[model samples]
Target chain A: MDVLVYIEHLNGKIADVSFELLGKGRELANALGGKLDAALIDANSDLATQLGSADHVVCAVDASFAQFSPMAYKNALAAMVKERAPRVVLIGNTSMGMDLAAGVSAATGIPLIAYANHIAVRDGAVVATAMVYGGKLFAEAEPEGEQVIISALAGSFSADAGKGEGAPIVEIFAAPTGGAGTQFKQLIQPEAADVDITKQDILVSVGRGIQNADNLEVVQELADALGGALSASRPVVDNGWLPKARQVGKSGVSVKPKLYFAVGISGAPEHIEGMKDAATIIAINSDPNAPIFEVADYGIAADLFDIVPALTERIKSG
Target chain B: MNVVVCMRQVPDLVEELEINDAGNDLNREYLKYVVNEFDEWALEQALLLKEAHGGTVTAIGLDLPEMDNALFTALAKGADAAKKIEGDFANGVSSHTAAKLFAGALQAMPYDLILTGVQSAEDLDGQVGVLLATYLGLPHVTVVTGVEVSGIQATVRKEYAGGMMSEFTVSLPAVLGIQAAKQAPRYAPVSKVRAMMKEKKIEGLSSSDGAASSGIKVRRMFKPEGGQRAEMIEGDADAIAERVVSILKERGLVK
Candidate 1:
């Protein structure tokens, strides 16, 4: 195998981003005429067995690898990379992925390209594409050396179940010790969302332009009238205006509701990827050129303040 | 305590940006520059730490024409000192090179903690702080939202996906990739910044050794591939609301 994908697991379940990378890694491996391999640290054997996309699965099931200790993962992966010498390694551009990728890249002196949206093997080297200028532009990077590791952005690629007939060859690798500088204390999950926005059929999403916490009532009224849940962009959640669970974006809930009303959301690429799968997306923003409008099914260039109340009234009366 | 904040002047993407004719980089001639957003948060964290712990916060950036204003603004916002590296960091391809530049500059300074943004808006790599930690041989954490220093070890809260948070007790002389400040970054008015510009001097450090060339190279940069155009809706408030209601009905979203 000449290409390796790190399988990320959280809360005893495989992360969706890991499967997305596997799909992408399978493509890159095919492009290079190499087998695809998956790396899992402290992952369940059953989870590794299901990664049919990979030709082989390497599991470091040490107790130390149970939780995400950057040094522990870095040391283990670095050891594997040292032994495997794969041409390219792919990781998800998530919290764990970023930490692991950076540590391994630094430890092994391998070049790393982060937030890669696309990857291709050209002339025997991985050509990774990443977004820049806050997703307004794209740049293709080619690592100057034989080895390259990239963190592919979440939602950039679709996850696919690859066709592999036989059980993948699972190699159990021993985890390395000697990480004393940092320790994993605990994982504090957000309190269960009062309303799981993912299950809602309709989502009324607000963004920074919602202005203030007091103004949320107007948007909520629309959501209430439509019999939908109220959601928000990162700013609204970060501002403590909304619970984190009601946030929609790459880092928030991925909602594919029947109708998504984006009120005042400028639609950053991160935010767009979350609800881009909505059956109907209606964006109301004051900025005519907001990127949300570009992806919206129906984009109205007006202040959401005026539109939300009017929309709420109409939904109630009509 | 001495704290260093890695600051960067990035192209203000709110303004229009054009790819240079070379096809691999931005056209610098027309783009306006401002402090990278996350780096501003990192600076605020550093300032807040200085306020609470009675330490000096020194901000450093690559020597760019527009960085003087950013450093001066930081000074007005309570940064104790500022420094700019002398080199062509614009052409640097990866965080590795930038981290090397920073490491080279910091080798002589005594510091208890170093901070930088989790990532840059332009590169979005989130690699600099980690790489800097590696080069400096220090413990490091990324995407940190909260920080508290008690003696030598600091307890920090790191944010993960799905709103998960992890608390870590990292030893001092560490690097943190600050995701956000405990509070919003303080606003420094242009007049206050101008006053600081007259009162402060950003120490210039020559990177004569030059940043080691990065292994990552840009092949090309272009706009995203085209997709279907969105349908624009035009009308007054009531008219648009009606349109939305009708569309919802058409989609069976409303009875």
Candidate 2:
């Protein structure tokens, strides 16, 4: 049996997620006692060797692949899948991961079991567990055949997984391409910013009800006292009251800080889904029925207008 | 300045709705729907752009009954035409899927640019614009806060953490997820509501129950428990406010 994992990267280096995928793939490969392979399609050869732990690293390299060209990347991986006929494939559930997973699944007409946090083969079929309903429910999926496709949810396993293991096995394979289907005219990169919220330990996010520009100073004071990152909801960013970089919902960054505070947010499910994994949550809102309270470890029923400044002063003094 | 605005109607998220207990299909009875809040911005931006540019504005929606109000408003705002497509909603389609669908509908009739909300009020994946570009194979600039069209390429400003903004250039046929007020959405005239209702028709088509197509299936429903109580800070309204602030500070919420 063969299980193929899709390798992902940014600028030729393996993405953090690829390691996580390897960890999950390792378990599945060991379980099936099957060879684990990876599709490493990139311009650089170094990343291919690093990801070589795969019993077979299906290498598809070309100059155009320094950055992801959807058509080229998909074509290469599809060719590998067609050739190998692997029983299952695993990918990470990130932006790139989701796109490739969907595209590949559609092309192959294979069922996609995405966002799987756990998986086990029960009596031969691949059974996967995925959290659904905004991390509110877990679905147990057992595909009927040996063939399956899955994208592992991020942060599912301990960081320890990256620490273990032998050097990746390496192999080279042919890629499918005529290059006629899709061509990237240009690749305009967003300006690089130093704020990587994923690396932050704490994120203090402000919402709309802060009452205007002056209250923002108080939020600033609080963030300084915590010596942590400060972020905002879409409204705060949209209103020109906060910078777009600070927006913390799906459009912004998906963060898992050690502590997250929701200040006056009504707790849209979209926003909550992005942050519910924070180690601790405290919600402050004037509305007694604010949805943020539903997920907060501690809730405050008071106007943010009144509380923000006071909190800032207290923290400064403390 | 030919501009295309996109909007989608979605199930109201605030409601405590459920999937039909009897099956995986939606429990439409308890569901309330809306003009997908952010999509409103996309529609508004289109109408505003058309007013500024000489070209006609056409609004396309994955036709649904509830979108009639929104489509008519788009027309009243002077959209030359409104095209509706019945699309499969259960699929976890990528913005790539949208580009595939939209590119086909738009090939014969193309625009200088297309705008969408940063994220849908429901799915909020924040990847639509990026995905669409991949499918249509156009260059895209996203997380945009401001834009200007010069020749066929666009110069756009994007905001980042710490109040930083950066500008990038994207060529035409690009998909952008517009932030609210990048350009203020014009208010629809009160008098036009009735005419819009008469003139607008929403179009819709459902794909097969492809909920599990993405391999991301919903197996069961679970709601987080929330019973821990908040102890109000003791004092008068003003004093109480002060106390709560201190609590927030104590909790590292605010300064």
Candidate 3:
């Protein structure tokens, strides 16, 4: 009943998603009456104290780890798993996590179930719940073998910083001594948008339903009337109707605006992953059953063609 | 350069889906299948690479009733050759099983690189490409947006979280999970697809080799609990606008 959680860090601080995994990992370990251990590729002092919930913190310090190299991370994690043979391993469902998990699972032949929302020990086996059919359905899965790895979907669990007063035992591990075929070059940050929608409290975000490029003017007019910034879904950015900077989705800027207006946006789970934290979300779509309505505060099931002009006029008159 | 892309036919999710009586899988009664979007990206990337660098692009998929459309579409979209493996994966096979089948069939062919979608919406598992790479003992990367191939080496742009990207140089005989193809998958007119169906032959491979157990099983599937339900505001266009304006005013989002 040993559990291991992989800790991800950026600029020496642990990513929030890693803390969420730690919280869930601690719960799973306690349920199975097992010890929880945290595995980190980089050595960061500030991160080690926050992992007090874990009985041991295994750190593999290497200069290569300053930037994420999937091969390097996979080599280190696979070695750690081989030594500890933890029953369950938890990783954050970030891009780096998915990349590393794929290689590790293949290299070790361990069972992996990604996009897990809930994990538990049932009947002496690790059971995890994951989404299928684009978040329309959920499946509960169990590993056929003794060992399993589960990637925690972001924002699924509450992150706990831990309550223990004493620092956890830290064990330093050696980096893998092999040629990493892939080299990590510089990380290219997206060019700054003329307007950083992340700083905007009110946003008028458009999606595929905007129909055509010419129709964007109406959405723009609405944004102007509402005193909000113009934003968009991935499709808009992909279609080159808007800058990539204004895109709101898993691959775009995560926004916490106060009032978010979703116009003609069908809520894909990837898009929802970014804007779900907004204070108030109002979604407008013709389809009543589009997933956007499920998370929106106000769901308007009407054509934007009919709704936009009237809404814009009202704000203008007032 | 020789490129291979693995495409999968999935239930078109735009249409309504119902739970089967077994309560563990989707009802196949009303489901219409189509090539997965991500795999379409993979196919397009392979074809684009073939166009840029002189190579033959081969597309493969498991045999299904809806598979012919996918294969012929690949041909119409400029795939040099198409293959359909004779297998009944209708009920749905694990990514591990599919990867093994692909790897087994690929062992006979000369290939410089392999590609597939990052994950399928149907299974939501992103392991097939990685498993295939592992089975073939090749270096691999996932969520690739761009790839520049040169002889035995490749430079790829891999997307990470928060819109950050990293450029990597990997040796050839590698696998990549295409997050987005360099170009949107070309739309072939149905007439072209029909013409290709009659003019070109799709090589069928029978792969009866048993795959190693996937070591994971689904216990059950159920609809997730509703997270938040929207407040329905039904009215005429003008009435709705008034309601929305008042709400916005209350929220202090308007001037």
Candidate 4:
């Protein structure tokens, strides 16, 4: 195998990032003139059938593999990498992927480049463009080894390209056993919905620049004036100022509102992943170089404290 | 129980970062350095564990500029001991190299749990804790939000994407990449920190020479190309607000 894409799944459903990797994996495999393989752990034939873009589907089936056991999954993936010796392994740069990528690389002694947003074959060597400094800079990097592991960031490729109908070879093998140092108890789902930000046509989103929980009223007034709900970035949610339902990001609700009025939000890629598809984005931040400006349709490089209240009053009067 | 928390300083993002002449790294001469935010949470988690389970918390960091002040601050904030791993970190070390150095320095220490930040601005790889765990032959967990210890077992709360979370019971002698603590990290008074600087000492540990390279070589570093940049609605705050209202009205977002 030339390119191996790790298929990530939850609740028996394959993750979209896995499909995105498969799309990129197919392209890289074709460039190398080799086969693209998808590695599925404890997944059913139904899931395997969905991985038609890959030339082959390698499944490691075991009872313990049903749920994500970090140690077990790490050992199994490392073993597969050793056995297959694929030139490049593509894993989604997601929460689960972050847990496994470095461990697998260390176990197999293969160099890993993470946070990759763009990858290509150059001079017969795989080079990747990785996001650094919270997406403020891009680092073009190449691994120095026969085999390399690249954890591509989510939203880097198109999921539609990886979806199609084609029969690929399927192989099943028993997973390695007996490294159970941790036990998964239960998954805590998000709190019951207070207000679904996804259903709203307009959203007033705030970030760390909101300053304090008490300061949320400034942005709340804007959202009320616009006849929309208030949402926020991860920091605001993590700070306990906003409920999880009102958060927008990869780990929060993805919102595609008609108007995304951002105040004080610096657009990290994870935060951008959720709201980038908004119809019209307007951002207000003091930092002129904030990444949020890159995605906003209109922006004001001014203090949110000064602009937000004024905007709220203007909209309210009209 | 004994705990070790690894921390590092990163270039403060508040200041604009400029690439060095090498085209592969940041220009560090005028950069302000601060403790990596997630690592502060890791230290807080360690302190919490120590306070609950009766153990000593050891704060360890690479020998970078202003690291001693961070260590003293940690000591003032409740850490029992501090150690700085001496190494050639002038240009900064990759996560791979830092993991190796940390592993080397930790080989002789007695630790029931090792904690580190899940990721940093420089190390978006999020590799150190996991790689360090691999080197130490210990089980590791990442993105952990909270940890509760009883006897030799710890029940940890790990966060997944999309507001999902899971509980895991991990055995002792494990490594955890802490995402957040139960509460915000406590602040150390400047006066107490000054007392720690005067009364306490940070032990120095030497890093092994010629630590193996991380293998991934940066060819170049550059700012991201602007993609459909937002049209600037400049001037004072009032003008900006008026323009925003007009845009919203034009788009029919508001009447």
lDDT of each: 0.82, 0.62, 0.81, 0.86
> All candidates' TM-scores?
0.92, 0.72, 0.93, 0.97
Model 4 lDDT tens row, A1-318: 389999998888899999999998988998888999999887355589899898899988876677776777888888898899999999987778987899888888889898888999998889999878777788999887667899887888999989867999998856686545877778889788788889999899999899889999999989999999999998787667888788898778788999998999988777888898999999988888888888899988888999999988898889
* Model 1 lDDT per residue over A51-105, tens place: 8778899888776666777666777898888788888899988877877788788
Better of 1 and 2 by lDDT: 1
TM-score for candidate 1: 0.92
DockQ of each two-chain model: 0.60, 0.23, 0.63, 0.75
State the TM-score, rounded to 2 decimals, of chain A in model 1.
Answer: 0.90
Tell me the spans in candidate 1 whose CA falls farther than 4 Å from its real position. A43-47, A122-125, A162-165, A286-289, A302-310, A313-317, B90-93, B124-126, B235-239
lDDT of candidate 2 over B122-224, digit per residue (tens): 3312234544554455555444566666676766654432334445556676776665645445667857966876766544433322222233334443343
- DockQ agreement of candidate 1 with the native complex: 0.60
Model 2 residue A81 CA deviation (Å) reads 3.4
TM-score of chain B of each: 0.92, 0.75, 0.93, 0.96
lDDT of prediction 4: 0.86
Q: What is the C-alpha RMSD of each candidate to the true structure, in Å?
A: 2.6, 5.9, 2.4, 1.4
Q: For candidate 2, write residues A41-103 as lDDT tens digits.
A: 877557755664566677787776666655567667767787788888887765456446645
Kindly give the stretch of ten consecutive residues in candidate 3 chain B with the minimal lDDT sum: B118-127
Q: Write the per-residue lDDT of candidate 1 for residues B1-255, one digit (tens) a residue.
A: 899999877787667678889998888876788887889989989999998999799999987658988899889999989999887655433577678889999998889999998887665444788888877888888888889999998888888766788888888899998888777788999999999988889999987375655577788988665665468878898988898888888889998
